[model samples]
Target: MARFYCDACKEEFEHSSPSKKEYTDSFFGCCWQYVAPCPQCGKECTEKKEPQKKKRTSSSGGGCSSGCCGSCSCCG
Candidate 1:
C-alpha cells in the first residue's frame, strides 16, 4: 500500500486497490508517477510517492537498559 495526495478531491488517500498505475509525468518532464482514483470522491488524480515512514524504536534500540532490571525487555 502507498499513500498519495489527491488533488481532484483535495484530500490525501491510500492507493492499494486494483487499477492503480504509473506513467511518465509529462507535466514534470518525464518523472514516472503514480495515478489512481481518489478514495473518497472517486475522481482520477495524480499523486507523488509519499516519503518512507520512519520506524518506531525505543530510545536505546535494544541496548542495555537504564532501569531497575537490566535484562528485562520492558526496561528502557
Candidate 2:
C-alpha cells in the first residue's frame, strides 16, 4: 500500500494503482486510475497514474507488469 496525502481532504491513506488493461473504452484509453477514500474526510477520490511498462525475462515463462502486484509500500 502506498500512502497519499490529499490536500483537499487533508488526510493520508493507502493507494493502489489501477489496471488500465482491464478497462476498455474511448475515454479511459491507456491511463490508469487509483481509487481510495480519504481517512479524515471520508471522501472518495480518484487519482490517475500512468501505466509503466517494464521488460523482464523470467525463467518461469511468465511476464510481470510494472510495480509490485499493482500495490505499493506504505511509507508512513
The residue ranges of model 1 lying beyond 4 angstroms of the native Cα positions read 18-31, 50-76
Give the number of the best model, judged by TM-score: 1
In the order shown, the candidates' Cα RMSDs to the true structure are: 8.8, 15.7
Query: What's model 1's lDDT at 24?
Result: 70
Q: List model 1 lDDT by residue over 1-76, tens digit each.
A: 6666767666877778535454576576545455777768877776656479999655554555453334566644
CA error at residue 64 for candidate 2, angstroms: 40
Off by over 4 Å in 2: 15-30, 46-76
**For each candidate, what is the lDDT?**
0.63, 0.53
Candidate 2 deviation (Cα RMSD): 15.7
